[model samples]
Target: MLLIVVLCAFVVFLLVVGVASFLRSRRDDSDERIRSRLGALAASDADVETVEYLVRRQMSEVPWFNTMLQQMRWAANLSRLVSMAKAPGTPGLYLLLSLTLGLLTGYAVFLLSKMLIAAAVLAGIVGYIPIWWLKRRCTKRMDRFQEQLPEALDLLARALKAGHTFGGGMRMVADEFDEPIGSEFGKTIDEINYGMDSDRALDNLLNRVDCPDLKFFVVSVNIQRETGGNLAEIVGNIARLVRERFKLHGKIKVLSAEGRISALILTLLPFAVAGVLFLLNREYMSLLWTTELGRSMAIGAACSMTLGIVIIRRMIKIKV
Candidate 1:
């Protein structure tokens, strides 16, 4: 009788614990959903459905932690580009893999360095270096993509004027022009024919490209759909505006090029001198790697070099 009573008590305890756990999990999931929805609302001025769609699309591409990392990367990248901005890691899984490689490289560099503390400090900076460079490369690519957009729109307009359907014109661009702009438009047309709504298809294109200029292009098209207009004329105007902006930007870049080159030389000179000195007179330079005073000097040199780089970059960046 006592054994039967004890068994019953144990079973009841287990059942109670399981039910509590289940309730807690349910609450946590609900809280997460609410938080995500709030975040979506904050990030975009999109309608609830649109925001939800974007959130789901992003979530599907990356798990939670990775999504957070990519967002952080995007913000950092956007801070640097004064002309056109973009979010990171939307194009390819290669970006995520590059991040992992960067992390490993940082770890290896840390392991190899003699000073554990400095190594760890440098690890984070080094890890982000690859990501920063990748962001720069992507930024340039996106700029080219933006530059091509207005021209492509004009082409579509011309094709339309000649009585070709929108999809047929897009196919022409895809066949005639280079990636990634032509390819992106081609994908949009293909998706539309595959039963996707034009709005949703364009939205997907916007996400894939993730450029502010491209966003403007997509918004323009969607608005034009609801209220009829001479699309070719609108596109031509956009093209003219873009060309003028690019001309101004090109002039600014040319003016700043000499200063940038000078900055590069100044920044690299000290490091080059140090390398030569270390190679030519190891005994004299050994103090730097071996002594605390030398270490302090090394740190100072690094900090000053970093400050100079930042200042030079700021000076050269003339926002249009």
Candidate 2:
């Protein structure tokens, strides 16, 4: 009982600390922005103070904890995932959430099953919930961005035809369209305005948005800049192509709808049946968890089901 109490206390402490750090980071970011503007306006002769100020501004409020996590190999990847998901929390906060979830889940399972192995497995799976949620958010956001890309391109082409510069056209798109697309383009414009190379800024945009249509637009712009061509015409053509591709993609999804539905039913049937059986006759279903042979068969069935699910998913996934 004491151990459990201590563990719960530790988890709560971690959560409180994580929340505090997250709020502090938000405040610090605003302060950093102000300091950056001041630093920019300061005399160049105060180079040493400027450097020190910049370094201090970049450091996290909880230096030891943040530094330890940042030094971990997965930290960079987690940060990228958080950025892609457009999550408000920092990577360290996300990690803390994951850890808390895992430990609480493991403890609950252990209490119920009195089995370390079962607890560990459940804990591990639960630990990935945050990452799974992040990936899903990123996927949906990217899908929306892709859906908006062709229209954004057309808007840009019109802006260019109206005698706006490329940067002006980008700013127009940034101002006119809604999120993900607008925000991404706005970021690229900010980079360009801040003296980043146009190609580099666009490349960064490409890296952030993971849309093939956007890639085509970026490649076209780069090619136009290097080899010389009518920018508006090129972008217009790319926009048209993207629209056609999207149409074809819709047709493909329609054609694959049956296969996808079948896969979903097939994947869920086993679990659904087992659940029903457990509710109807707990003793009969208990064999699967209570006996060695039954446990082996259950594991084998799970493995086969997982493999089948993967194969079915691949079969239904049509790439455009």
Candidate 3:
């Protein structure tokens, strides 16, 4: 059947993608990669004529397409998001992948429903998956960076109390800590040493890292530079505050477990019932998708279910 052919092709595509991802993860050249990116940060200064010639970021490998993407702000944002996520592949490459998958899925849906509008809408929605995946990756990386922040701060505080200079303290953190915090601080130090203003370097780090707690650290350091304070004590206090917040975050997660479970059950209840009915009465359940009116009702039910899930998730998600 056409459905089988389409599904088989999709499965092949998924297999290829999964294998590629596994291989990339196993590449494990992160140290050299970190050094190269840190080196780039120094070279990318506005003062460096060499930086102009360096291919810092390309939205696409293709000349015309890259030029077109350069003119599009959203595409540039996507390229930046990829960098922040430390993800491989250009925006153009991901777009191509999404388009291919969307076309495959849309064709299959068309084959089943013979509905142009529905197929097109579904294709558009599905095409966003790759971008959504990149954003998800970025968020997870940022969360990891945040989790590492408190310890990095404590390390820096210890370095300062041991009589190291501010830059030296940062260098110690860079050498001792792991990524993304290590690479981030190392990059900031590189920028500052390479003639960028300290403020500018820290601001660039802030842009690269999306942790709210880092903002407190940055603001504290800046204030210390202006008004003068025991920087070690200040940083140590921030570290303690961050750890306390983590404890509170754990408590919040425990408290919200019940709402999460309820939401999950509510979301799954319809699917469980549908499965039971299908097992008990295949012909009746089959009519749902096998007829026009049944298809319309199925679409309505799907939309309503999606809306309900979104509302429930929003209700349960708590911010730290």
Which regions of candidate 1 fall more than 4 Å away from where they truly are?
Answer: 1-113
Query: What's each prediction's TM-score?
Result: 0.65, 0.85, 0.82
Mind giving the per-residue lDDT tens digits that candidate 1 earns over 1-320? 69546745654554454344334333334544454444335334446576555544231133553456346656334333311233332322333333444445545555555665566556567546645676677678788887787777678778878888767877887777787787677767766765567788788777667566566567777888899887666666766776677788899999999999999899889979989998999889888767899888888888888898999999998987
Local distance difference test, each candidate: 0.63, 0.81, 0.80
| lDDT rank order | 2, 3, 1
Q: After superposition, how far is residue 232 of candidate 2 from its true place, in Å?
A: 0.6
Best-fitting candidate, measured by lDDT? 2
- TM-score computed on alpha carbons, candidate 3: 0.82
After best superposition, candidate 3 residue 148: deviation in angstroms? Answer: 1.1
- The RMSD of every model to the true structure, in order and in angstroms, is 13.1, 4.0, 4.6
CA displacement after TM-score superposition, residue 263 of candidate 2 (Å): 2.2
Worst 10 residues of 3 by lDDT: 18-27
lDDT string for model 3 (156-266, tens) is 999999999999999998999887999889888887777767887898899888788888899999999999999999999999999888888889989999999998998
The most accurate candidate by TM-score is 2
